[model samples]
Target: MIKQTFTSLAFLCFALITFNVNAQDFKDLDKSPMDAASFPTSNRVTEKVVKVIYSRPQLKGRMVESLTPHGKVWRTGANEATSITFYKDVTFGSTPVKAGTYSLFTIPGEKEWTFIINSDVDVWGAYSYNKNNDVARATGTVTEGNKSLEVFSIAFDKDGAMHLGWGTVRVSVPIK
Candidate 1:
């Protein structure tokens, strides 16, 4: 009985120490937290047509133009470049793209934004962006929103239109 008790105590002590160390190793939330948006967002619709994973960066009292300068390639989000996956072949804006995952980048303009779907996947910021690897380029109309969004966000409407909004600027890209 004493041996069994000692074995149990030893195991309990080891478990406690392991749990304490593991609990401390957990990291806090990222400053620019990752987010995802999918078409057919309805819970009943298990089949997704398109999906985008990106990081949300807060405005933090900074201008949108300052964060994403005009006439320059932006990663489309914070941290890693935004990735967009299409479950099947579809027309994005006016450009036809095959069913695959691609890195999403954008060039901000005064009245429109050029949405670039690059073949490269799992890339960091646009530091290594190469225009030659572009799969498709589409034009997204930029419009002023009545309500300002503090954090950058991407969402898809029921009609499969992708909308990107930040600080009162809204860009809509149609998909069919």
Candidate 2:
């Protein structure tokens, strides 16, 4: 009985210490993530359509090419693979994609960016990117925006073209 009591006390102390350490870790996160969505809100007449769930990574002190090197696949956001869901069949450029969920990835380049839709879902990052699982590929026109963007953002326009902006680089891909 004495041995069991001593063991229980020790376990309780260890658990308390572990909990305290984990609780303090949340404060270290500089950029708290957010989930952004497309479509109308409030009294807008446009019905809901596409949506994206991703972490908004900020450009605190990082360069665009340094963060997303040329010729390499970018998850598009901070954590977890960027998810793009389509409520209806849409033509991404000239390629038609069915209404479903897919992993959104991009290859940032100096001239243009290549938008990718992969069949593989629920992936963590570009580490699991496979060309074999790619469903569609579209070229996005990269242009310089008038304003400097601090955080990486993905938003869709009224014409169903989704735009991605980070720092000074902006790219758009038509989804309708």
Candidate 3:
């Protein structure tokens, strides 16, 4: 009787462990809804610049009211602020922007978008956003997107330039 009980208990423990392992494996196979959702986005790479844009679903609404609300610090998207990498120094809105990787953030308003260049890099999101580390800030105009964007995304223009706009506002950052 004792032998049988011990063997049964060991078998039960092994089965439980196997079940737990399989459960974890199954969980890994499941994709998050956010990850599965498709967003309109694109990317462009050139000898001088790499540009990306995040167009949210709300872009179909009014530019000033729908896409970017007044007096809000937008992370640019779910990830780190919209990012751009330049191969050489370039001038942005009369300010000289140096070549390097930088996080692009914006303060959206009715009239314009205040584009920010920060020192932080490779961050998971804007959770670590620090305004004090800002390298430069430039004001740019907002324009309507040619098509509707379902998801927030970034893309580069034909000229190796960066354009970020959703709703009613689009800002262009040139690559040197």
Best by TM-score: 1
Model 2 lDDT per residue over 8-81, tens place? 99999999999999988865554738677675432375556677888888888888778889999999887788
lDDT of 3: 0.59
**Which digits, one per residue and each the tens of the lDDT, describe model 3 over residues 31-62?**
21122111122323224333343324333334
TM-score for each of the candidates:
0.87, 0.80, 0.62
Candidate with more favorable, higher TM-score: 1 or 3: 1
The local lDDT score (0 to 100) that residue 119 gets in candidate 3 is 79
Angstrom error of the Cα, residue 69, model 2: value is 0.6
- Residues 78-111, candidate 1, lDDT per residue (tens digit)? 9999999999999988889999999999999989
Candidate 1 similarity to native, TM-score: 0.87
Q: Candidate 2 — what's its lDDT?
A: 0.85
Model 1, residue 74: what's the lDDT?
A: 98
List of clashing residue pairs for candidate 1: none
Top model number, lDDT: 1
Error of 3 at 18 (Å): 3.6
Question: How would the candidate models be sorted by lDDT, starting from the highest?
Answer: 1, 2, 3
